[model samples]
Target chain A: MESKEINLPLTDKAIDGLQIGDRVEYSGILYTARDAAHKRLITLADAGNELPVALQGQVIYYVGPTPPRPGRVIGSAGPTTAMRLDPYTPRMLELGVKGIIGKGGRGPVVREAIQKHHAIYCIAVGGTGALLNRHIKNVEVVAFEDLGTEAIRRLEVDHFPAIVVNDAYGGDLLEAGKAEYRTKAPPSP
Target chain B: MREIEAGVITEAVAKLAVEATHFLPEDVEGAIRGARETEQSPLGVQIIDEILENAEIAREQMLPLCQDTGTAVVHLELGQDVHITGGFIMDAVNAGIEKGYGDGYLRKSIVAHPFGERKNTGTNTPGVIHTEIVPGDKIHIGFMPKGGGCENMSRYQNFLPGAGREAVIKFVCETVDQSGGNPCPPLVIGVGVGGTAEKAMTMAKHSLFRKIGQRSEDPEVSILEKTLLDAVNALGVGPQAVGGSTTALDVFVETYPTHITALPVAVNIQCHSARTKHTVL
Candidate 1:
C-alpha cells in the first residue's frame, strides 16, 4: 500500500482529505498524553486555566512510553487503547486539537466529535514500539512529570506510520473494514 | 530433599522479565509469521509484516516489545519435597519485579490504589503470583508479562448447566466481536470451560502457554478448540480488527471438572505480542 506522508499541525485540507483506511506517515511534531495527563488537562480547562501545551491545530498521541535506555531518545512507545480517552476527546476537540493518534476503535462520542470538530483519528500498529521509537527523533517532558509515564511529552518526529481509523468526514474504517471482510473473507487456512 | 535459595528465584524472575520483553516467544513469532501467508486483506498482511519487524527490532536492540511492558504475572509450581533456605517466596518474587522493572527500564504500570490516590508504585512490585505445590523437587515458573490492552478485553462467564456447547460458542464469538481492534488481533484466544469461576480464569490464562494448533489431550476438548478457532475467525475482526481474515491465530480450550449446576467459562485474550517464557529450577 502506498502511504501518504503528512506534516503535522494538520491543516483543514489534510484532515478533510483523509479517508478511513488510508495509510499515512506523519512527520513534524506530536504532543503525547495518556490517561493522567488528559485528566489534568481537562481539569485545567474546566478551571479556565491555560493548558500546558497549545492544542490548536496539533496532534495528540495516546501513549505512555517506557524510559529510554542509555543512549536512546525514547523507548518502546506504542499506542494505548484510544477508547479510554473518549470522555476527554470532545473537550479536546473543542479546544482546537485537529488530530488524535492511537490504536483501536473510538467510541461513538469520539467519532461524532471527530466529524463535528473536523479532526482526524489515526492508529499506529499497537505493540510495535521498538519500530515506532525509530521515527520519534526527540522527546521531552512538557507537563506533569510526577505522573511518570503518564506525563505529557512533546515529540519531534520523522515519518511516523499510521492509518486513519476515523476520518473527519464521518467515515469509520473499523466498522467498514469489518463489514467488508466479514462475508467475502475466508477463515485463515 | 532439594534446597533452593530465595535469591535464586528472584534472579531468575529478573532475568526472565527482561528476556521476555526483548524476545518474542518462538511460538507467537511463528504464528504471526504464519499470518502473513493467510491474512487476506492487504492491510492486515502489512500489519503482520510490521509486527514481525517490531519483534526483530526489539530483540536486536534489547528493547521492550511494547511500552506497556505489562504487569508481571507468574504461575509458579513449587515442589513439595523442596525446602526454601531463605526468605518468603512472594517477597522474593516482588523484589525480582522491582529490580527487573528498574534495571530493564520497563514501564512501571501498576498503581498503588485503584480508587484512592492511584499513584504509580515507582517499582513494578506486587506482581500477580500464583503458586501450586506439585510432587517433584523442582520449581517450575511460568512468567507472562500481560499488557493492559488484551487483559481488559478478557471475559469470564458462568453459564447455566443447560447451556450447551452452542451457547458457549456464541459467548466466545460475541466476546471477540465486541473486543474489535482493542485487544490487537490476530489474537490467541484461550478458553477455559468447566471448573469454578477463578479456576476457569486461571486455566484460560495458563492455556495460552500452548503453541499454536496444539490440541488438548482429550478428544472432546480438542474439538471445542478447533470449533472456537474457526468461529472466532469467521467473525472477520482481522488483524488489529481493521478487517480481513485471521482474527485469531488459535483458540485454546482448557477444561476442568465443574459443579453439577454450573458451567463456568473464561476467555483470556492474548495479543500478538504474547510475552511468555518459562523455566524449571
Candidate 2:
C-alpha cells in the first residue's frame, strides 16, 4: 500500500481527504498525553483556564513513554489505548484538535465527535514501541512532569507511520477489515 | 536442607525483570513470524512484520519491548527442603523489581491503590509474586512482564457445570471478538478451567508460558486446546486486530478438578509482544 505523506497542522482539506485503511506517514509534532495528563487538561479547560499545550489544528498522540536510557531521545514510545481518552475527545475536538493517534477501537461517542468536528483517527501498531521511538526525534516535557511517564510532552517526529482507522466522513477500517475476512473465515469448529 | 541466600533470589529476579521486558520469547517470536505467512489481510501482514522488527530492535538495544513495561508477574516454585536466608522472599523479589525498573529504564506501572488515590508505586513492584511449595531442593521462577492492554481484555466466569464444552467454546470466541485489536493480536490465548475462581485466573495466566504447539499432557485437554484454537482463529480479528487469517498463535488450556456443581473459566490473552523469562536456582 502506498502511504500518503501527511504534513503537520493538518489542513481541513487533508482531514477530509483521509479514508479508513489508508496508510500515512506523518511528519510534524504530536503532543503526548494519556489518562492522568488528559484528566488535568480537561479539568483545566472546563474551568475556562488557559491550556498548557496548544490544541488547535494539531494532532494528539496518546502515549506514555519509558525513561530514556543514556543518549536516547525517549524510550519505547508507542500509543496507549485511545478509548480511555474518549470522554475528553469531544471537548478536545471542540478545542480544534484535528487528529488523534492511538491504538484499538474507539467507542461511538468519539467516533461521532470525529465526524462532527471534522477530525481523523489513526493507529500505530501497539507494543511496537522500540521501533516507534525511532521516529520521535525530540521531546520536551511541557506539562505534569510529576506524573512521570504520564506527563504531557511536545514531540517532534519524522516520517512516523500509522494507518487511518476512522475519518471525518464516517469510515472505520477496523470493522470493515474484520467483516471482509470474517466472511471467508471458516465457521467455528 | 539446602540453603540459598535470599539476596541471590533478589539479584536473579532483577535480571529476569530486565530480560522479560527486553526480549520476546523465542516461541512467541517464531509464532508471529508464522502468523505473517498465514495472515490474509495486507494490513495484518504488515502489522505482524512491524512486531517482528520491534522484537529484534528491543533485544539488540536492550529497550523495554513495550512502553507499558508491565506489572511483573513472577511465579516461584519453591522446593520443600530449600531455605531462603537473609530476608523475606517477597521483599527480596520486590527489591529486585525496583532495581530492574530503575536500572533497566523500564516504566513503573503499578498503582498504590486500585480505588482511591491511585498513586504510582514508583517501582513496578510488589510484582504479583506467587510461590508454591514443590517436591525438590532447587527453586524455579517464571517471570512475565504482563502488559496492561491484553490484561484488560482478560475475563473470568463461573459457568454452571451443565454449561459444558459448547459453553466454553462460545465464551472463548466471544472474548476474542470483543477484544479485537486491544490485546494486540495475533494473540496467544490462555484458558484455565475446572478450578476455583482465583486458581482459574492464575492458571490462565500461567498457561501463557507454554510454547506454541505445546499441548496439555492430558489427551482430552489437548483436543480442547486444538478446538479452541481453531474457533478463535476463525474469528478473523487478525494481527493487530486489522483482520486476517491468524488471530491467535496458540490456545493453551490448563485444567484442574473442581467442585461437582461449579465450572470456573478464565481467559488470559498474551499479545504479540509475548514476553517472559525463567530461571532455575
Candidate 3:
C-alpha cells in the first residue's frame, strides 16, 4: 500500500491510494447524526422515501456535539461509537455514502458491507471533542431540529482528521492491531 | 442539630457540575498519563496523547471532554445532625443541575420518559439523587456524570452460590471484550460483588467514583481487582478499542456478604474521561 498526502474536497478517485491504517487529513463537507437520526434515515430508506439530503459519495460523521460556545460555529464535536449504527450502515452504503467517521470498532456485518459497497470506516480521535471541533468552521442543523443535540447537522471542516480502521477490501485495523499487541496471561502456580 | 442552608447545597452542586464537566480530576489525568507511557500500541499511544490533549483543551477553553456531559448523578450523604433551611433538599440539587448545565453549555441528555413520547427536560434537571443519612455535622456530595456510551454497556449477572470467583471473572472479561471499542478504552471497570441485584448495580455505578488505580482494602477483592485488570487488558481492547495492551487503566471492586443462594456481580465500564468530584459542606 502506498501512502499519499491529499488535499480538500476529496473524491473517491483522490483517496484510492490510501489503505487501512493510513492517516488522512480531510477538508470538506461532513454530516452528523446520532441514534435517532440514524433510525430515521433507515426508516426513510425502507419506505423508499427521498432522503433529506443526497448521500451520494458523501462522508457521514457519527456525532452529537455540545451546543457551541457564544462565538464558535460549532461546539465540541467528536466521533461517537460506530457499532450502535451498525444496523443502518449497509443501507447508507447502498445509497452511496462513501465514508463513516466515528470511533470504536464496527461489527463484522458493517465491515463486510464496507467491502461489498466500496465504503470506508474512518476513525477520528474519540473524546477529543473540543480539539476536533476546532477543525469545523461551519455548522447548521440540517434536520431533526426537535432532537436537540441528536439533531442532524451539516458541518464544514478543514483538515479534519481520521484513520481508516476498516476498508473496502475486508481489512480490519482493530483485529489486526489487537493481534499485534495481545499478551497471554501467565499460568497459575 | 445545626441548620444548613439549602442555598449552600445548591451553590456547591452547581459548582461541582461545571467543574466536573470542564476539568479532569488530577487522579484521572495521572491515570491517562500512566496509560500513555505504558501502552504498547502506537495507535493506542496516539489515542492517549489526544485524550490528554483534549483534557487540557477542555479545561483551558471551558469545554466538555466529550459532547455527552451525561446526566448528573449525585450521591448525597447528609449529616443527621445538620438541618436544612431555605428550601427542600431535592430542590436545591435540581437548581444546581439546571444552572450548571445551562451556564456550562453542556448538553441536556435526560428525557421525561424512557418509553412513549421522549421529551427533553431542557434543563438537565431533576438529577438522580440518592440520599443517605449519616452521623456528621457536614453534608458530603459525590458527583459522577456518567456518559451514555459506558452506562449503556453496563451488565448484571446473577451467579449461583457455587459459581465462585472464576465465574465472576469470566462474566466481566467477556462483557468488556464484547463491548469492543464502544465504551471508550482504558476503561474504568467497576465491579459490584454480592448484595441484591439493584444494590449490586448501584454499587457498580457508585464504584466509579473511587480514585483511579486505587484498590479496595479487602485483601481478597484487592487481588481480584488486579486479576480482573490483567484479564481485561489482555482483551487488547486498548484505548477506544483501537487495540492495545492497556484497555483498562484500573478496576475497582466493592463487595458485601450476600445470601448463600446468591453470588451476583455487576460490571460497569466507565470511559477514560471518568468525570467525578467530591465536595463536603
User: For each candidate, what is chain B's TM-score?
Assistant: 0.98, 0.98, 0.98
Docking class of 2: medium
lDDT string, candidate 3, B22-42, tens digits? 899999899899888889888
Q: Which candidate leads in DockQ? A: 2
The DockQ-based CAPRI class assigned to model 1 is medium
How do all the candidates rank in terms of DockQ, highest first?
2, 1, 3
**Native contacts, share recovered per candidate:** 0.73, 0.68, 0.64
lDDT of 2 by residue, A32-133 (tens): 888888889889998999999879999999998999999999999988888878888888899889999999989899999999989999999999999998
Model 1 chain A: weakest 10-residue lDDT segment is A180-189
TM-score of chain B of 2: 0.98
Q: What's the DockQ of model 3?
A: 0.53
Per-model DockQ against the true two-chain complex: 0.57, 0.62, 0.53
Residue B237 of model 3: what lDDT? Answer: 72
The parts of candidate 1 lying over 4 Å away from their true place are: A184-189
Question: For model 2, what is the error of residue A6's alpha carbon versus the real structure, in angstroms, after optimal superposition?
Answer: 0.9
